[model samples]
Target: MRGFGDAAVEEVPDPVAGPGEAVVDVACVQPSVTECMLLAGEPIAMHTVLAARLAEGPVRFGGHEFAGVVRALGPGAPDGIRVGDRVTAVETAPCGRCAACRASHPHACPSPAVLGFTGPGAFAEQVLVPARTLVRVPDGVTAAQAAAIQPLAGALHGHAAAAVHPGDSVLIIGAGVMGVLHTQVARHGNAGLVMVSGRSEAKRELAGRAGADLVMDAVGDVEAAVLAATGGVGADVVFEAAGAGTFELAARCVRRGGTIVMVSVLPDHAGAPLARLRERGITVVHPRSGGGVFEHALRLVARGDVDVDCLISHRLAGVEALPEALAITRDKQRYGALGPAQVDLFDWDRAA
Candidate 1:
């Protein structure tokens, strides 16, 4: 497993399933936030969080979240899952026997190696995954839709954490892919009104298409817009999906006692609004997917509660193309790709 932002792609040979694991003959690869980071040589934040538990050496496994068909299964694996079945995987594979996994927090597992980031990932022709990490794609869901399920989970988690209910107004702080998806997820959760604010005009339009009730310029006074749209009470929930410098506006736009949910990974070195958030007596939830969040997110996609296929705006097919794809997605909005830049990869023959 090797290749990080702009690095050479090496054919390290194919992989095989281990005991209780499964191998999916690669049919597609889902380009995610980590894919760009890995290709750019930027460190995945999870690495530091799990550094103490790592086995050392820079891991190159990438593509933790994607969908493909099960080609083979390890002996004694969970029986319901079988060969030729289509499925998506949870974020990263953690040793399911560790204290963290036992506690239903595989995300906090001691030894965490993310796929396509620090270890063998889905970008390649085949991927080896633990049996338990798999989530089946429903009959009606296309692979492209299934491919985006993991990210939707986090967005859903944000809405769930905010307790978004019918008729309640909501505000999303950015209009990038996560921001747009959060808008749809919030609407699906029955939020009465959903508004999105971003600096990019293109993103605002994307957000509107994704079900945003109103749009505001990120460079403008978004808090005032939210208040005006709500007749002065402000929104019920504020979503900080961009992890930008201005997320603190959530404190000003959310109604007193309303919730604020951070859905993106903010650059730690950047300033955080902890003090302002506390001063406003706001409760913030930064959801980490584990336990059943991914499954819940996937089920919604499968059931058509929230449609993410529209979020895809780009597709790439090989290691060589990944660097360019990563570059474009890193500044997804700058390139005028408001939603998450979907980079779908298929074998040359199959794609034809």
Candidate 2:
């Protein structure tokens, strides 16, 4: 990104692997909703860092959610990694010397290196990543599926935080990528009833197809519908995937002492109904990252437990289509897209 909103394809020097790093030839990459928001000047979490980067001139941005073939491994790279292996990586790696890491809570590391945000990402033909972050792609999973499974991993993290029981009712707010993934995960995890609230007709249909037993219109009385569905109680767990103005709604829809997982990357100053939540004894969980569950997410995809490919509504060929892909992903409703827009850099079937 040259400026706040400018992006164009240009030749840059190919990345070289350093010690404990590996160079991956990207096969499939997708522009995340968060990345698009940042590019569009939304004051989300990474706005400050990205603004600082743009001040320096054109920045190589995006492509954390990707899959590729290992092209080269630096000295001290893990023994398991090899050239020609298909893989995807955990985007965040904790700094081992940090207090959180030293205390065995690496997921809480405050100064972790984020793949697409902290350095050069896989938006190019090749990207360099820490070898330790790489996870070998299973035999049956497609490159596209690998590239898109990061959000599913995040849904898994949120489900774990909610500690959902077999019969717990799940309510997901927003029928975007994260919301649909959370719906599928809830169904597969044995949740007795699954409900989704969405503003658009297309997304509501998508939520139903993703296994939501009930889909409610977000413009209507979603809380009343959820309450009626749960026999005047409320959903046992609510995943607040919609950004900004939906936290209070999530609180209202969840039963007392139930869980609400904030799955969206909301702005820092976004308000929450703290007093109401406290009075009801609601547990609000903010899942930091999908750090430890990449492998499990891959297994779900490989086993056909979750359908990741169906969510991909737009696919453009080659890295040159990144700008279009970004546009579609940023405004999915305008593009009628159900998931992140994927850009295929190479034919995975023919790649070495």
Best candidate, lDDT: 2
Best by TM-score: 2
Poorest 10 consecutive residues of model 2 by lDDT?
Answer: 286-295
For residues 57-115, what per-residue lDDT tens digits would candidate 2 score against the true structure? 88888889999999999999987889999999999989889888999998888888888
Residue 109 miss distance in model 1 (angstroms): 3.2
lDDT over C-alpha atoms for residue 92 of model 1 = 62
- Report the number of clashing residue pairs per model: 21, 0
For residues 236-280, write the lDDT of model 1, one tens digit per residue.
888887664766677788887788887766655656667766776
lDDT of 2 at 313: 85
- Candidate lDDT scores, in order, read 0.71, 0.91
Q: Show the lowest summed lDDT stretch of 10 residues, model 1.
A: 1-10
